[model samples]
Target: MTSQGLHLIRGVSHAVFRGQHDDRAEECSFRFWRCGKGFEISVDGRDVNHTEFHLLWHQLVDDNSLQNLSRFDKWFRLWSEWKTLRDVLHCPTYTLKLAKTGTDMRVAAHLVAGPVDKPAYDMLPVHVSDMDNFAKGLPVCGSESVRPGSWLGHSPGPVRGPDGRLYTLVLCEHRALDAQRGEADMPSWDRIRAYVHLAHSGVDTHCIPRLSSLVTDGGLVAGVLIDHIDSGSSVQGLVEAAVSAEQLLSLEHKLALWRDRITLTVTTLHEHGITLTTPEYGSTIHELNIEVNQHDQVCMLLSFGTVSIVVGQAELEHKTSDMDELRTVFDERLPELIVETRRRLAAA
Candidate 1:
């Protein structure tokens, strides 16, 4: 049991963690309940003649630390022991039930799912080309023809290009692009060209998605097609999952590496006179993607969206503030974000 899980159990007047026990003979439900100063554990199935249950019962009975312990201490001991048993037995799913003291209060049930499966996509080849030729000869596809995938909501989805290679299209709203052009006095296509040029010019092109071609609809630039990331999660999603599972401490080193990768990538972009636009501020996490392998190695990738070429002093100041906010998020504000996520989970 984690400290956060123990805290939750202590705060609630009554709580229970229930799940199915691993049994080949018969399906059974095992429950652990914490009520006031006492606890109750039960197992129900068609066939209850298993030795595993008896073994667990005997193990708990033989444990002297659980005897004469305070309410919180005893519950903690029991939870830790049960969790060990559960993991060894391969019981994956659990439901946590929490209730207040008042009879009028309803018991809140939260189903804690097992390990999450990474997002899946069809394995496809990526088409890479120079930005100038790619943009010039790019085909215009109707927005209605493209279907969104699980990759990044409705914006980017895997699409086969003219060369029959798979790529993801990031559609830009024409109105928004025009607004940016009016503000910056630079065409949207020019900004994208400069951004892609800088990304390709870097020694580490792995962190940036490869631009293949631009997609357009009715003369307006709809989006650009970039290489598809095989198995990736948004940076925001990764952080939220770590916070939810209370694994932040164990994975802190990995997270730090990811942050550094992102910082280095952005710094490289800034050095090339490319900075994120004003609208992209405070939401840099969503623009970043990461893939972790079985060996625990991480590959970071940047999804280009709403970037501008730094032309003057105003743009330089904008870039400075953006970098500052990026540092603040990964460095100073991460703890607060984790706490806030925990609070939301508890409230829910």
Candidate 2:
């Protein structure tokens, strides 16, 4: 659907985010399309302007056009697109109101349940099929799939950052998740989790990963930030924690910590021999990165041991992997982090 064509579903998104967003962001988006114009709703909610959204949207719609904005100024351009879309359509701002179900989640149940007759599954052409060859002509590093600095398990598909860099959105790990409730094409929790696990923690001979683990095992995915309560918390605990963060932190702080924690955590997880390249469990495991543009609220991502620094426009991911015994090293990483925090807090 063309950007201007999105006006048809502007009201549906308005209705969905307002009443049903609480039930499920994905579902609301899904069902909103049952009203029949999905591409329109997504284009509108993504709210990027016609020209800019067109640049990114075109990449998504054409499987052969996916460009890594990291190679260009994508992160920034995404921000511009969102702003333009919002102003042009005048969408009511997307806000988060707390719920009892999770630390962080985008799908809601009730709104999705009501009148949600099945909308035929029409997957957003999120990937640019074999776009790699075509992308080489562009200025950015042309890769088939972007080697994300950090894999944040948010939702499936893609996210165009404020910078204009196109990010494949792998939503936070799902705990007792159900995506069928909505109208649009939202991936199952398992699909998303599989993607994260395979994408970031790829084929490792020693680590026998299981897709079932993402669904039922004590395995948890923190959908948003890393706060004190969630530092040692289980993945199941993260859902509520994420909701609280929306209530607690400002937009800018949230975005910063999202990038910070994921960058730090994924670098640490790699030592276990996970390359995030396999398919069996591609997008299942990940620490998500959420960046809010708002100012005021402040928070710190739980960067236990690793410290990240930006060398220039590019952020260098650095860590110490010289440890001989991997198990012994990971075992102590979190324990020592807790002790250190206590000491620092006491000294303060």
Best candidate (score: TM-score): 1
19-74: candidate 2 lDDT, tens digit per residue: 12221222222122212222223222233332333354344344233333234332
In model 1, residue pairs whose N, Cα or C atoms come closer than 3 Å (at least 3 residues apart or on different chains), thus clashing, are none
Residue 185 error for model 2, in Å?
Answer: 21
What is the Å distance of residue 237 in model 2 from its true position? 2.9
- Residue 274 in model 1: lDDT: 65
Taken over the whole model, the C-alpha lDDT of each candidate is 0.45, 0.27
Instruction: List the candidates' TM-scores in order.
Output: 0.46, 0.20
Model 2: residues >4 Å from true position, as ranges?
1-15, 18-31, 35-124, 127-202, 205-348
Model 1, CA-based lDDT: 0.45
Clashes of 1: 0
Worst window of 10 by summed lDDT in candidate 1: 117-126
Q: In angstroms, give how far residue 181 of model 1 lies from its true place.
A: 12
The residue-by-residue lDDT of candidate 1 on 1-348, one tens digit each, is 101112233354222322233433133333433321222223333223334443443333232323232244433333322221112112223343322224443323334442322111111112235434544534445433443321222344565555656677654422232444454323344345553565456445445566666554434445567776665455445556764445655555676876677677777777777665465322333324455544554444333334566678967876886687676667666656666666776776
